[model samples]
Target: MSQPSDKALVPFVSVDHMMRLVHRTGLEEVLRGLADYIEADFRRWELFDKTPRVASHSAEGVIELMPTSDGEVYGFKYVNGHPKNMKEGLQTVTAFGLLADVGNGYPVLLSEMTLLTAMRTAATSAMVAKYLAPKGATTMAMIGNGAQSEFQSLAMKAICGIDTVRLWDIDPAATAKCAANLAGQGLRVVPCASAEQAIEGAQILTTCTADKQCATILSDNMVGPGVHINAIGGDCPGKTELAPGILTRAGVFVEYPPQSRIEGEIQQMPQDFPVTEIWEVIAGRKAGRVKPDQITLFDSVGFAIEDFSALRYVRDRIAGTDLFHPLDLLADPDDPRDLFGMVQRAAPER
Candidate 1:
């Protein structure tokens, strides 16, 4: 067999490799790095192609294709959300993604994105909290303790200086799992019996449930003044975590207003319901949290640009490291127009 050319290769990061990469750079540092990249991209938000994720929904779950390009590089992620998978001892969410050079349309990076998604989601939450959470905030209420709960807790601790996390979930085992994972991570972990107890004295409230329906994991009555709400589980139509009244009372910030209106907490409200893009706030073009007593909400539904940023970050991080495998994902013919000839020439080796 003949060796393939360099152009035929693509860097692939597996789940194991992703974990190693995270450990190599240090988890908290990687979280901070992702947050920086995401924030930087958001500051130049208008330069990218922005659109809602293309989704295929069914009774079982939904599969989505989130794609975007910053004129130089194009990236996309294939992710799925199936709430019932947990009962069957499977992951509720799973994903993989790719980044390509737009000039040549050749893939540059391919990576498993299930774990990356969790990390970026938490980083984004913390980044937004850093901008909107009250001054000197140190405690956060983690309203759900599932696959994403621990990451969310650590991200807040790393990025927002949150020293304590109050956790609550419908399932006690989930809370126990999250707590066990968080041990010795430097934060005071508190397990609560109810969602109401979790939010007590918590300056930041993060709700990340897995259910695919319109579930009110955080009610208006449960929320108090001067808290930043990070609602991430409310993704896709009919899936939400915050109450309608809460949206009405808070200053809602979103990644992209068009996508959020269809898939975020605002889906429960009227079409004309107002929302401020977090990029505007980050860019100093709009206000984030004006008053100490005012409520702030980051209605995050996982935008494509964030994934693009993650792909970009991963590509840079794995530059000289063995944390990624080189995959022969493309056909590199000696002559660009000789694809058929190359295939025909391969019959002898077969």
Candidate 2:
């Protein structure tokens, strides 16, 4: 019998390997490269398959499947969100993803997307801020200080040149951990006492709390003009971070309207609420920030296309590198038509 061809083996990136890859390639470079890929995809947004993620909601959490394709390559991510998981010492979110060739329907790469999602989410936030945040912006207020806080700050530094990040969370220990993690990252990290203090003097206010309720992480009064709001925590149907008044006052931009309207911050508004898709802004079909004083909101809900772009970027970077291992995921018989013979031969050898 002949050995399985390369096509039968899928490249797998484990968690340890992913961390090594990040360290080997540099975190900032990876963030910037992911942003580049996401921006490129957004510019050609009309060419890909788009749909709201299929979700199964429960009292404790929700599981989701986010899928997208560009007609040449196909990608999808399986992710879950459970706020109570932290109490169990488990992650609030976890994910894995794959990329496949559209021509032959064969998977090319499989990766641990938990860390990659953190990077991609931050990259998406920073990329949106580059287009919508005030010109010459240098400070950001990060409202949540969990696993995502450091990534968001670093991505902003890499993409938008943000020099200072003010951190605040309900738990001081979380804030401390985030600050400690970002000590030598070349950015000024200020751990604030309250949400109001965190937003002070910040041009980009990012809310990423993990409460699965209509929780107000930021009040309307706390929000001021000329600030770009990256609201990522309001991802599920009932989960939100910003006050309804904030949505009413800001010019909201979203990834996909169909999904954003159902799962983003705009879910608080009327069904006919006016909002612009971010892809149009990247494509130059619509303006991002016309005036510096107009409040802008990016109600991010973690779209499939962003994951697709991240997978594409990782697949490219791991090429010819020791960052991935080959997995014998598919069965390739010596004769394509002789499936029973192959099974019988393996059974006898066993």
Candidate 3:
């Protein structure tokens, strides 16, 4: 009979361990690497197994699960969005994710995804902007100042070369917190009184408010020609940000059409409404920002492929590092037909 060996077992990663990984890898490098993964996934869009996200909505908040596979590897994330959580000294969102091997259906790694979601979301925005944003988008206006503000701001500055940030939120304290967190980040941070004031004369405009309903944060008059709007929030069925009129006037871009049609700002429009998927641009099959005077909008509802790309990124970047925990999601039986024997052996020894 074979006995268990003395070899070290799999290591588990905690939230603090992940933070250390981020600090060691550096945010800019991670963003750049994640962007490359996202771009590659988008380029081979047909190979991926895609689906609309599954959601569970409640009066207080909503929880969601996103899963995708690239034929070889599979990954999913368990995430919740509770806008009122801040009242209880918790983040509005909490998440964790898993990556598995499709051939064997065994979980290879598990890690906290709340902070990683922020990183991936910001990386995705900057990635889309790399293709859709104007050649030199310097000044960006951030309409929502919350937990995601600092991450988004840093992503733009590092990836898109944004030199100035204009911030505005309904709550002054939220804006103050955002400004304070980003103190001395090389970019000039400006706090504005209203959304209109914040977006005035900016090259790039990002709206990431956490409101659960259809909120018209950007109106037709507020949006100027030649502006790139990165819509980060409003990812669910009833959630929307741009006024219907604004969508009609601008060239709207999306990550995946099948899912975005149901979750993106395009949800407010008819099925026949014209919009371009960013993958086509990345693959050189379509054009992005053809002219400087053309208004462009990326209705980002977030996607599973981005998470898949993120898992791939973290795995490759932290290969030897301890940022991942080996999860025993699958039961391994020494003998295929002796599962009950293993269970009996594991029961309290008498």
Candidate 4:
């Protein structure tokens, strides 16, 4: 076998390469870039083919495939959420994604989405907060200090001008880990004793706990008026984080109602419970925060379109750089009709 042509190889961003790329480009810069891409796609949301993620549930966890296409490119992510994994010294969520040319159906880029998902999730939160968060909001209450805590804090800082993050978790060690990681990241990190304490004096309240149950991370009385709630943890059918009273009081916003109604905080509400799509708010077709006293809730259930945007951003940003390796993932024969001949010709190398 000679050398494989470039068309047969897809660019693969490994975990190491992704870390180097984030370091080289600056982490906050990448977060802001992802936010921009997500926002841009949201502005043209009607152009994409959207659907709820396909999920397979088990006793331990759930695996999902999120897919979307915007006429030119198609993207999908394979992700798993296992809250029990944390206690087993493993990641609660891990993912990988691919982007392909819609016309030719050949993958153009493949990358680890474990880091990318964390970044994009935070970016999506902050971007929505930009439109719905109280004006001039600078402080955010980070209620969950898990793997996503640092990314969410920095994204808010970089994208929404938030300079202070008050961190809290049921586990003090988790809060300590989050605070220590964010110590020198240009934000004022305060360790709070409880979730209520974390939200004190904060304009934006972010909840990201991982219990895999309908536990109330934020109670009704704990949440006051005029704060924006970025609820991102409840991503499965039986998982939730907020009180029903909070949802009834807040003006709820969602990415896609079909998915959010099944997997978000709004899952606690009735089937006909009113909710506004965040894309409409982003496109200026609906209201965001009309009054300071009105509570704004973004019941975020991770959507496929956001992953498509993040994948698109990674593909464009990694070009002309040695941040990814070429993966011989596809078999490209000289003649499209003779796949057997191409395979037989390569058998001698084995």
Candidate 5:
């Protein structure tokens, strides 16, 4: 038999190409597809090898590494959260990620994840909403209208059937940009002046604010019964969005308890605080939305499995598009036993 043609190298996807992939497929389609992948991963939760995220922090910001494996494949992303960077015309966060074949510890792909992170984050939030939010929920209160606002709005419109979004941001310009970017997405955007005004009469409340400290964007008094809270930005230790009282009254749900307890809104509660893990609910081992009066909280710290799903989803959608680029991050030896030879082949010039 003839030897197989040299397999094409792994594609390296850039921010520009990824955005096109997202735009062409339509945001709703992407969210719907991504939710399926995320939910599938949740069903096979036991199949995954997970670890708490690793973080390196400075006074200005935090850089995190989230890694996970499903025996066959492994992936990780390097992401930073710096709320102050935007003032200097830099992104508040910058990211890149890699997917590897764990069987050989070889990197198969590299891609810019800054924009991808926004997409994945919104996708994950919508996934939780589909399973936890009340049926036929069409209105959402999106707190913090910054870089993530447009993506969250798009995801909700695409997956949750949300046709109207109530937007609130401390900065009016941020809200304006959010509305402007989302023009003609087939949703009604209502800009509000305060957090309370935004949450009014909305079934879903998404807090994607970037304050680096514990700030109450939503108070206990503002939250009503049956509202699904998608808390996205309270991901780091000191950062939070909901008041402590709010968590106490809600039937809190988290992605991973151990990591979430340290990083989620549950951190404010006692060590023995009762909360449901979303995977159990998705697997039907636990109940979700048992009552209309139940205030469900998805304390989203943005888990690794979600990122795994996103990377996999992007890979499939952009397969033949040449939207990705390959990086020489791993070694492929002609002979498996010639490890030394591979090292010598890659040595620096004399």
Candidate 6:
């Protein structure tokens, strides 16, 4: 037997390895770095291949493939969302991803995306808030204290200078857990009794509840002027966090309109509803929060380009480091046309 060639080996980041990498680089640093990558990609949003995530929905959940490319490299994530999974002691969302060279379509990296997705989602939120949130904002109300709650809080603290996070959830235990996890993390973690209390005095309101129905976490009157809403949990069809009146009044920003129209908070709006892509705002083609009194809403649906940027960031950071293991994920032959010969030569005593 021969060792696999470098070309045949792909860098793999397991859950353990990904955690180690996060700790080694510092979670705050990783979040900021991922924001840098995401911002860069969003600045040049026209180059990448963009499409809505292909989703297969069932009574219980949805499985989706989010794929995008930037000419040189391509990336995609396989993710599933099963809100009921928590009842069975499983994560509501789990994911893995791959990156490949577009030239030959050979995989360059294979990694766990569950953690990466959390980090990227937080980073993307903070990034959008950086652009849309009121200047000098220090408090964020995080509704739905699930797996994403802590990450979102920390990212806001790290990237957007948010010093306080007010948390609430349908399950008080979840809020307790999130508050406990965020203790001594350089931010004030406040567990509120109701959604209105959570948003009180919060300049940024982030709703990331794990529900599959058209539930309104924030009503129109609940949202006052001069607030930025980062609505993330309502990411698929039939799920929404904000009320229609909120959408009617706030200046809405989205990742991609086609997908957001079907999957984000805008799903509750009209098909011809006007919205601005965040990329356009980042590129200065559109306005962000023009005035402090204007309410801004970012209808984030977790675009493929964000996953692509996260994968690229991970691939670049893991270079010359022991954060990843090599896996023989590709079949490579000395002679490209003699793949059969290469395989037959390896068979013994047949």
> What digit string (tens of lDDT, one per residue) describes model 6 on residues 1-350?
68789999999999999999988989999999999999999999999999899999899999999999999999999999999999999989999999999999999999999999999999999999999999999999999999999999999999999999999999999999999999988999899999999999999999999889999899999999999999998899999888999999999999999999999988888899999989999999999999999999999989999999999999999999999999988888989898998898788765
Worst 10 residues of 2 by lDDT: 341-350
Candidate 5 similarity to native, TM-score: 0.93
- Where's the lowest-lDDT run of ten residues in candidate 6? 341-350
Q: Summarize candidate 2's per-residue lDDT along 1-350 as a digit string, tens digits.
A: 45567878999999998999899989999999999999999999999999899999888999999999999999999999999999999999999999999998999999999999999999999999999999999999999999999999999999999999999999999999999999999999999999999999999999999988899999999999999999989998988899999999898999999999999998998999999999999999999998989999999998999999999999999999999999989877778798788777776443
Q: List the lowest-lDDT window of 10 residues for candidate 1.
A: 341-350
Superposition-based RMSD of candidate 4 using all C-alpha atoms, in angstroms? 1.0
lDDT of 1 by residue, 97-210 (tens): 999999999999999999999999999999999999999999999988999999999999999999999999999999999999999999999999999999999999999998
Q: On residues 230-346, what C-alpha lDDT tens digit does candidate 3 reach at each position?
A: 998878778898899989988999987878888888899999889998889889999999999888999999899888888787777667766665544455667759879867777
TM-score of candidate 3 relative to the true fold: 0.94
Worst window of 10 by summed lDDT in candidate 4: 341-350
Q: Runs in model 2 with CA error above 4 Å?
A: 1-3, 348-350
lDDT of each: 0.93, 0.94, 0.85, 0.95, 0.86, 0.94
The TM-score of candidate 2 is 0.98
lDDT (10s digit) by residue, model 4, range 1-350: 86788999999999999999899999999999999999999999999999999999999999999999999999999999999998899999999999999999999999999999999999999999999999999899999999999999999999999999999999999999999999899999999998988999999999999999999999999989999999999888999999999999999999999999999998899999999999999999999999999999999989999999999899999999999999989889999999999888888753
lDDT score at residue 67, model 5, on the 0-100 scale = 94
Off by over 4 Å in 3: 1-12, 347-349
lDDT of 5 at 175: 92
- Residue 124 alpha-carbon offset, candidate 4, angstroms: 0.4
- Clashing pairs for model 2 are none
Which residues of candidate 4, in runs, are more than 4 Å off?
none
Clashes of 5: 8
